[model samples]
Target: MITSYNFYFCYIEIHEDYVKAVMKEGITVSPEHNDVLLQIVEKHYKNIPFVYITHRINSYAVDPTIYLETAKISNMVGFAVVSEDPKQKIQIKLEKTFFNKEFKQFDTLELALKWKDDMIKKYRD
Candidate 1:
């Protein structure tokens, strides 16, 4: 089953093995905002490996340092960003620096979802 949550900053869809987030336009995502993600992880994904996919439908800024805390989530197997914007691809490269685990960028959500499944399978093996 898929579950959804709407926050002031983002709209999140939680699947069995992945969480997709679409951040609101023009907002700056900071480390403090990670608390909301952490809570969702604890409540819905505790002890189970999952991937996080950020679907950038709207433009926004992200604190690279936020990945530092996100990297601590033991159950999180990978992080993927879905965006067609060339600028976002550049931003993702910088963001990947702060993340300790697998980080991938895709032009489409379908591609990201496939990567997420592969990541989870690899993690379980």
Candidate 2:
């Protein structure tokens, strides 16, 4: 079963092996947002491995530093960003630098979901 959540800053869909987040337009995603993410992880993911897929349908800014605290989540197997914007692609490069684990970029949500499955399988194996 897939569960969905609506926050002021983003909308999230939680699946068995992944969490897909769609951030609000024009907002800066900072470390503070990770608190709600951790709560979701604790409640739904717990010990199970899962990937985070950010479906960037709307324009937004992200604080690269947020990845530092996110890297501390042991069960988080990967982080995937999906965006068609060329500019967002460039921003991803800088954001990837701050992340210590598997980080990937995709032009579509389908591709990101595929990566999420592969990441979870790799983590389990």
Candidate 3:
């Protein structure tokens, strides 16, 4: 498990098949935050399709517009955001339309990883 605090509000963790990010409570997650994540993913893992899993542990706001530019990254084959919040669930539904890659929300990390594995296989095939 690789871990680093890219920003005081955001902590980045890398796994074998994906990256898990945790943000400090109530911070607005914007394009700048997404940019840092993309750079980290590009720098550590290469040549194989992988996932960006946001393990939401705190209340925060996200800019759905970032999805447009995020979709343009070919290596980012899927996005798995794990959350159990009802309010965030609604926001996630709205964000889905802007995301070009496979996107889903889950209640647990195990399920999210399973979906990520399946997506990677699907895209590679």
Candidate 4:
């Protein structure tokens, strides 16, 4: 997995097949930052099947549209987000739209990773 993080954002790139990768950091609400993020994801990782977000809401509000676009491009089959803030609801809606369905959410990254691992095993078989 490849990772990138700035003061305002963070991302991870999973480079395995039959195995999914996830970004543990959440993104900020800035349009510019989101744009930069999209470019990065597009440029470096476009085929990952799963992505996990761990950015806290206080640091930055993640725009769901950005994640939606990423999922669209990555053809991401599943997503797990860990946030304690209610504001993340908006992102959740956006994720659902991007996935055309609901995604799993957890309060901790460990749960998300465990779930993703189980999912990968299921999908791989």
Candidate 5:
């Protein structure tokens, strides 16, 4: 089950032994606006080895630097995005450069889930 924090637009899923968080639309990747996001992630996911991020996060407006910084602090297995827009090709290229080995951008949520599952198997005993 996914529990949502409507105020911050984040969905949290608590498993038997792990937690997963999916950030919804309009998730600000700026330093100033990330306070709530940081808090929520820290509260529920700080110790989780695997975290998954789905949909609506491929916007060109997001600051890659800020996003990368947040991801680094969280120490997630990686994040997978779902975006098929042709306009986002360049943005994906640039984001890939920034995230490098820490993130994977995909065109579908299924692929993201698969990636997360694989990570869980590889990293989580």
Candidate 6:
């Protein structure tokens, strides 16, 4: 477990080549949210293409405008979002126009993790 600190809204796991973030419910995602994520990336992941996987397990509000700036983060190569909610899926579609989500929304975390592995494999090869 990541015992560094209690990141209330999100719990993150740093993989070999990707970061998986599981967001909590009833929260709002804003520009400030990126700061925490970036800190993790800077501390744990560097000198490599950055991949982000978001497991949306609960309802939350994400600022649509923030996606643009989020894309500009250094070395951001890909993104994966997992959610079964119809509303969230639609939002993901809208988000696709701004970001390159090679591994888009999946109904389950297992499927998303598989896709992340495939992405790493492809990147390695």
What order do you get sorting by lDDT, best first? 1, 2, 3, 6, 5, 4
- Return the TM-score for each candidate structure: 0.98, 0.97, 0.92, 0.57, 0.72, 0.83
Cα displacement (Å) at residue 9, model 4? 3.8
lDDT scores of the candidates, listed in order: 0.96, 0.93, 0.85, 0.52, 0.61, 0.77
In model 5, which regions exceed 4 Å deviation? 8-28, 57-60
lDDT of 1: 0.96
> In model 1, what are the clashing residue pairs, if there are any?
none
Error of 1 at 14 (Å): 0.8
Q: Write the per-residue lDDT of candidate 6 for residues 2-62, one digit (tens) a residue.
A: 3333488777877767788877788888879888887877787676776788888878888
Per-residue lDDT of model 1, residues 1-125, tens digit only: 47999999999999999999999999999977899999999999999999999999998999999999999999999999999999999999999999999999999999999999899999999
Q: Please give the lDDT score at residue 66 for candidate 6.
A: 71
- Cα lDDT tens digits for candidate 5, 26-105: 55556764566567667766676755564654233566776656566544666666677767656767767666345767
Q: What residue runs in model 6 are displaced by over 4 Å at the alpha carbon?
A: 1-5, 101-103
**Clash pairs for candidate 5:** none
Model 4 lDDT per residue over 1-125, tens place: 44434433444443442223233344345446556556655565466544444434344455556554555544445566666667665666566665543377777766867776776566557
Candidate 1 — number of clashing residue pairs? 0
Off by over 4 Å in 1: none
lDDT of 3 at 53: 89
Root-mean-square deviation of each candidate, in angstroms? 0.7, 0.8, 1.4, 4.8, 3.5, 2.2
Q: Best to worst by TM-score, what's the order?
A: 1, 2, 3, 6, 5, 4
Candidate 2 per-residue C-alpha lDDT over 23-115 given as tens digits, one digit per residue, 9 for 90 to 100: 999999987899999999999999999999999999889999999999999999999999989999999999999999999999988998888
lDDT tens string, model 3, 16-77?
A: 77888888899988888778877777787777688988988898898899999888888888
Cα deviation at 120, candidate 3, in Å, is 1.5
For model 1, give the 10-residue run with minimal summed lDDT.
1-10
